[model samples]
Target: MANRSWLPYSISGEIVRGFGRGSNELGFPTANYPSSVVDALPDSFECGIYYGWAKVNEYPVYPMVLSLGYNPFYNNTKKTMEIHILHNFSNDLYGSHMTVVMIGFLREEKSFKSTEDLIDAIEQDIAIAKEMLQKAECLRLKESFSYDL
Candidate 1:
């Protein structure tokens, strides 16, 4: 785990439209941040999969898996911060304000030979996030002032 100082990083931004593949293809719906938020990331910030806590608007906090990188599998030209909140929502939150408290890294982003492989990896990341977020420290952060959930 490099750049430990960046842990528990707090960021808030409006959820924007993404490629739509996250749910239509991968079966996971991700809330994406605007490019400005992505650009503001520290140069030293690690580009990888991370587990964190997220809240939309005034909703309760939920465990989440985030990818901060130019997803190699998709060959994206731009960098992105895609957050997949663990809970299912009945409607899209495209314009809602989302706040995330990143707590720990899972793995570096990687390309896959098939879309199935990428989905599998994402599922594994979600499982890891669910377990890690159960920790007392993570739970405390979920209720912290930064979240305002």
Candidate 2:
């Protein structure tokens, strides 16, 4: 594995509205960050899928999968930071303050030939994230200062 020089990278911002496809089409709801938050990423932070821990406002920490890239499948013009928290919530969290500590990279973002392929890849990413987040080191990231919970 490559050295995790970016491990424990932290960022916090209010969740913003996205393209509205994560839940409507992909069955995964994602919390998006504003352009200012995305612009603050380090130059070395690669465009890829990552697994991490996230906290929304004062809510409990949860495992999460993040997509940091200009989504090729949708031909997005601007780079985006989209996070899918691995827990069910009864209400939309838009505008809620969220903090995340990225623990590990999962895979590079790619364009899919079809929406089904994209969904399949996202599902696999979710599975990989769930398994990886159970590791001792990753679990310990939940205690990092990035998250208030």
Candidate 3:
């Protein structure tokens, strides 16, 4: 089982730099976060699809699709945390502090070809995640069955 406690706390940080050739599809302008900022996160963080709310210092945002993974299609290099803010989330978070509130995990990260394909897959993931999140029974099941690992 994967440990998720590492990400227990909501974090506020800046986008210092970002890399890779995959973020373009999500309309996520890629940039890297400083080592200090990234390292501040827990060491045992679990990687997966996540839905979250982000408050950008410069702009407003709605629910954002957060992804943590190594892009296998582009030769897995470094792991990344990329977010695709929903419409009305346009703002420069590059040098500003943004707070991300993780709501739920969608799925383990994986790479797919074709921008359209990726977007379609994300749409489905988000739909399932939203439905699951809204159901108290489902959340109970998740907690009751969830293991610390």
Candidate 4:
């Protein structure tokens, strides 16, 4: 299991451009923290899926599902912190400032046998995140998360 103490953590940074797979392949657009920000995380922090709330620029807080890992399924060579905000944006977010308050862990990162399986897992993760973030504790965190960025 990953170190839970490191979580319930908040981080703010610019969303940089990634490989463009999230939208082109998965149909879900994701925002990522720059490598400098991502590298600041503690070394023992294992990669996995997480649930929480996030704000993009001055936008309202939104439920989110995060995939922090090397993406074994995609054979990614570098680690990434990919956050999928559950909202449709009418504009590009390539350089937007985003903040996330992670409240809970969903599952360990795993490789799927096929793209269909991976998509299914992503859909499930979003559903679980939506439900979990609605809980009292998570709701409280969501309410407390600052939207200044």
Candidate 5:
């Protein structure tokens, strides 16, 4: 089990282009972080799906799900932090500075039986995250979010 001691860890980084799977294949667009942000995480941090709050370029905070791992499904060798913000945005997010406050862990990364299974898992993660972020404590994080952090 990952150390739950760092449940609300926060990190900031500029969005970068990923493997294009999120939007092109999975239908869920994600704002990816450069390797530096992923490298800065604590040694105890484990790869998994996490629900959190995120804001781009100091915009209003929104619920987010972060996939931090080697993405076994894609057989990726490099680790990544791919964040799927809950709200849809009209503008392209590449190069935008984003800050995320991880609030809770949902599940660890795993390969599915098929692409359909993977898509279903992602959809379920989003739904569970939306419900979890509605709580008073999680709401406080979103409500009190500031780029200053």
Candidate 6:
């Protein structure tokens, strides 16, 4: 874990500012996490697909992608932070506490033939992700429905 101090802010806190950056050229709307919380997180965090929520100005941003795998095509390095925001929702998110809660794993990261191919694969993956989240959401609703009865 990276040794650092806690941020003056907390999760779900208000967004004071925002910025955009393409982490590893993936055009991920990367947000800054307090080094303290970043360090506190388990190092064994999975690198595959996961469901989570991010707070932009303290609003839940669902169906977002949070990646922690090496970009073999871009860089041979491993465990780089990356995330592609879903649903065409784009906004400045710097200096905001974006919390990602891991929900599920899609598949292990791998290389593709070309950038287009990679993008195509990502599109398919997004489809699968939406399906999974939908099912999960349905199950949750069902469970609640049963309880309400």
Please give each candidate's TM-score. Answer: 0.94, 0.92, 0.68, 0.95, 0.95, 0.62
Runs in model 4 lying further than 4 Å from the true structure: 147-149
Residue-pair clashes per candidate: 0, 0, 4, 0, 0, 4
Off by over 4 Å in 3: 6-8, 20-32, 58-61, 89-91, 129-149
Which digits, one per residue and each the tens of the lDDT, describe model 4 over residues 22-67? 9998998899999898899888776899989899888899999999
Expressed as tens digits, the lDDT of each residue in 62-103 for candidate 1 is 888999999999999999999999998888898999989899
Instruction: Give the lDDT ranking, best first.
Output: 5, 1, 2, 4, 3, 6
The per-prediction CA RMSD against the true structure, in angstroms, equals 1.8, 2.4, 6.6, 1.5, 1.4, 7.8
lDDT of each: 0.90, 0.89, 0.60, 0.88, 0.91, 0.49
Candidate 6 accuracy as TM-score: 0.62
- Kindly list the per-residue Cα lDDT of model 6 for residues 27-136, writing each as its tens digit: 44445444354345556554444434443444534555555556555554434544455645555665655544444566667777777676676677677766765676
Report lDDT (Cα) of residue 114, candidate 5: 92
Candidate 2 per-residue C-alpha lDDT over 55-86 given as tens digits, one digit per residue, 9 for 90 to 100: 89878888999999989999899999999999
Residue pair clashes in candidate 1: none
Give the local distance difference test score of model 6.
0.49
Worst 10 residues of 4 by lDDT: 140-149
* Model 6 misplaced stretches (Cα beyond 4 Å): 1-40, 76-78, 136-149
lDDT of 3: 0.60
The true-structure Cα RMSD of candidate 6 reads 7.8
Q: Which ten residues in a row have the lowest lDDT in candidate 1?
A: 140-149
Residue 28 of candidate 1: its Cα lDDT? 92
lDDT of 5 by residue, 30-111 (tens): 9999998898888889889999999998578889999999989889998899999999999999999999999999999999
